[model samples]
Target: MKPGAVYFMANRKNGAIYTGVTSDLIKRVYQHRNGLVDGFTKDHDCKKLVWFEMFDDLEEARRREVQIKKWKRHWKIKRIEEHNPDWDDLWFDIVK
Candidate 1:
């Protein structure tokens, strides 16, 4: 359906932070949660879905993802705060 750049905030409970962009959020997150995908996320246990932005264009989403990747930690936190001020784990919200 919609092309999106979804980033996950990985942590047991408000712990580690992980940012990622994916076209398919559901499948991607499932893999992260299940530890099917190895690397930074799996090693750090960063499975909290915090903030995500949807874009109709894949190019736009990719552009945003790249931009975010270069952003400073505070900048990323500020961006996330725009929607999730409390930084609550947004895992269940997406499924509903």
Candidate 2:
């Protein structure tokens, strides 16, 4: 089975954030970056991949995504900063 990932995209450091889950992280993130996926990410211009966590089980990833989505904004920001203090675009890291 394909690996699954829970990811966070942001417009900039401490900017609007969009959290999602995908079976193909690279393709999904690419779509968001290029504005192929309509809705929140596109509307908010949250195209920079700032953080992600891979999971062996797609269901687990989905559950995590849902959990994160319900979190308060500050909690979500804290989680992102814990892993990515600088909020660097993680696209390079994933593609490389």
Candidate 3:
């Protein structure tokens, strides 16, 4: 099975956030950044790749995605800040 990743996208520091899971993290994030995918992320302009966690398989990533989705806004923010205090766009990291 393909490895998967749970990722967070935000419009800006402390701005709207979108949580998602995918087997291809780089491609998925690319779609979001380019406004290819329609839905919450597009509506909220949550295109900045702020954080992510890779899992051994898609099922594990999906489980983590569900859990994170249930978290309150503040909790999500804390998670992002803990790993990325500046909330820098991680696009370069993934591409390279």
Candidate 4:
């Protein structure tokens, strides 16, 4: 199978922003949701999956992650709003 990567944004139950990359989107997100991962997300309660982009190539995904990381807070908010105007958590939507 070709490698796939996802860059996702999470906010504290309703605050802050956390960006992350994962080859296994579902599992990684699950870890964050349950506080199984350490550092940023866990401490900040950044479990909501506000936005994500998928890529077939790891390098492309990495590049996108770097770009997003460097973006201004307003740009990131705009990016998320474009795809998820409501800023709703998308985790449950995927499994259904």
Candidate 5:
């Protein structure tokens, strides 16, 4: 199976947040940023990669995604802040 990742995207530094799971983090985030995927992220323009974590299996990544998505906003925000204090778009970092 393909490697998997759980990630977060935001509209801006302190804006709407979205959590997702993907077998290809780079490609999936690219699709969100470029509006290639039509859904909440596209509708809200949640393009900034605030955070991400890799997993050896897709199911594990997906389970984490679901759990994170259900978290209280503050908890999720704190989690992201811990990983990305600056809340920077990590796309370039990952792609390069």
Candidate 6:
């Protein structure tokens, strides 16, 4: 089975965040960055890939996405900042 990923995008550090699950992380992140996918991320301008977690099981990624979505804003922020204190836009690394 193909691997899947749960990723979070932000407009900036401590800014609006959007969590999503995708089978192709690189493609999905590209779409979000270019505003190709409509809805919350586009509306909120959350194009920065601040955090992501890969899973061999698509179901696991989807479940994690749902759990993170239900989490408080601060908890999410803390999680992101823990691995990515800088909240760097990881798009560059994954893109090329």
Tens digit of per-residue lDDT, candidate 3, span 1-96: 779999999999999999999999999999999999999999999899999999998999999999999999999999999999999999999999
Residue-by-residue lDDT tens digits, candidate 4, 14-85 = 358887777778888889899999998888888888888888876777778888889887887887888888
Q: What Cα-based lDDT does every candidate model obtain?
A: 0.77, 0.94, 0.95, 0.78, 0.93, 0.93
lDDT of 6 at 35: 98
TM-score of 5: 0.95
Better of 3 and 6 by TM-score: 3
> In candidate 1, how many clashes are counted?
2
Error of 6 at 42 (Å): 0.8
- C-alpha positional error of residue 45 in candidate 3 after TM-score superposition, expressed in Å: 1.3
Per-residue CA lDDT of model 1 for 1-96, tens digit only, reads: 457765856575346678888887877887888889899889998777778887877678888888888887777777777888787777788778
Compute the lDDT of residue 88 as modeled in candidate 5.
91
The local lDDT score (0 to 100) that residue 12 gets in candidate 2 is: 95
Report lDDT (Cα) of residue 42, candidate 4.
88
- Per-candidate TM-scores read 0.85, 0.95, 0.96, 0.88, 0.95, 0.95
Off by over 4 Å in 2: none
Better of 2 and 4 by TM-score: 2
Question: Which is the winner by TM-score between candidate 3 and candidate 5?
Answer: 3
- Which candidate wins on TM-score? 3
Q: Which pairs clash (backbone N, Cα, C closer than 3 Å) in model 3? A: none
For this target, which candidate reaches the highest lDDT against the unseen true structure? 3
Query: Looking at model 3, which ten-residue stretch has the lowest summed lDDT?
Result: 1-10
Q: How far is candidate 1 from the true structure (C-alpha RMSD, Å)?
A: 2.1
Q: Please give the lDDT score at residue 90 for candidate 5.
A: 95
Clashes of each: 2, 0, 0, 0, 0, 0
lDDT string for model 5 (1-96, tens) is 667999999999889999999999999999999999999999999999999999999999998988988899899889889989999999999999
Cα displacement (Å) at residue 17, model 5: 0.3
**Which pairs of residues collide in model 6?**
none
